[model samples]
Target: MLKLDHIVKDFGNHHGLRDVSVEFPANQTTVIVGPSGSGKTTLLRTIDFLEIPDSGRYQFDDLDYDLSKPLTKQEVLAARRKLGIVFQSYNLFPHLNVLANITEGPVQVLGKNKQEAEAEAHDLLKKVGLDDKADVYPDQLSGGQQQRIAIARMVAMAPEYMLFDEPTSALDPELEVEVLKVILELAKMKNSIVIVTHNMDFARGVADKIVFVEDGQIAYQGDPTTFFNEPNDRIKAFLAAGQFNVK
Candidate 1:
């Protein structure tokens, strides 16, 4: 299981996270939702070490780390091999084609052969509905297509845990669906997945557990059914403003 205890992130003027503690069980999809600047993204980033907390204890199965200190290069790389993250901006290599972008991590980081990596990349491309785009670069694809390719690239590494930080926030509503579809599919297949998104409809459909963050703290954490169907006043207000669908 993945767990955090009393995690705190200070940004001088404001706190990104304040005495936060949560657990993300294996084989469960956990979705984090909150209003803007409520530390939802910060919580996700901390899990993947994109942003180190000022004070906290992070534990993943056998490994444990004190978040008060910066991690060594080797420590970060070792941890990252088990964790994969996709940001809002699809950070593909402009110089490399889709196939190269997807194969790079497995070949370089995981020590897989070029041929094997390429073979898996092709299969992943097909999974994302973008097999034909393997020869194209990031600049050539649309926003949705690029995001889909980004997902494929991350999945190619086959991390034990997957993290997405507002992945569809940058796309148009139509384009957002394309990315969300791939993510939903991943949530179904992957063992551990955490997503931070504002789309209540997608969150309700995809998450096994829902975590509501408010003012740098977790306001609620429970099964998605109760989270959406039996919301408290604060959650009800959030749902009313958060593009929620009652049906």
Candidate 2:
């Protein structure tokens, strides 16, 4: 299980997270939703240690961290190996072909032989429906295709937990669905996944638990059905203003 307690991140003038605490259960998909600049992304980043918090206690399986203190390089790396994150941008190496990009981590970090890595990369490419594009460069692929490749690359590492921060926010509606489909498949495949997104429909359909954030704090956290069907006044207003077609 992944857990956080009294997490706080101050950006000098404002707080990115205000004593926020939440638990993400193993093998469950947790979807985080909030308005723009509500610190939802900040919260997600903190989990991966990309944006270390000012103060808090974080527990990832048996590893524990004191957010107020700096973590050793080895500690950070050990924790990161168990988690994988995909961002809004595909962030693929433009210079490398898709297969090479996917194999790089496994070969360099995990010490897998090139032959083994390439074979696994080919299998992952097939899994993401990009088996034919392995020889192509990132620039040659469409935005949706590159994002799918990004997912494939992450899957190649076989992280115990997958983290997605607005993974499809930059793509068109149709393309966004393409990435969401892969995410749904990962969730069903029993990976512990945490996603920060604004897509209400996807969240409603995929989330086992919904966490609502506003003003750098959790406004609500519970079942998706209750979050949508029996929304409180604040959530009701947010849904109406955001124009989410929840029904």
| Best by the TM-score measure | 2
Model 1 lowest lDDT segment of ten: 238-247
Displacement of residue 178 (Cα, Å) in model 2 is 0.9
lDDT of 2 by residue, 1-247 (tens): 9999999999998989998999998899999999999999999998898988889999999999897898889988888999999999999999999999999999999999999999999998888889999899999999999999999999889898899999999999999988899999999987899999989889988999999999999999889999999898889888878787544
Per-residue lDDT tens digits for candidate 1, residues 1-247, read 8999999999999999999999987888999999999999999999888888999898987778888877888776667778989999999999999999999999998899999999999999999999999998999999999999999999888888889999999999999999999999988885589999988889989999999999999999989999889888898889988667543
Model 1 lDDT, residue 199, Cα? 88
Off by over 4 Å in 1: 245-247
Once fitted onto the true fold, the runs of candidate 2 whose alpha carbons sit more than 4 angstroms away are: none
CA-lDDT, candidates in order: 0.91, 0.92
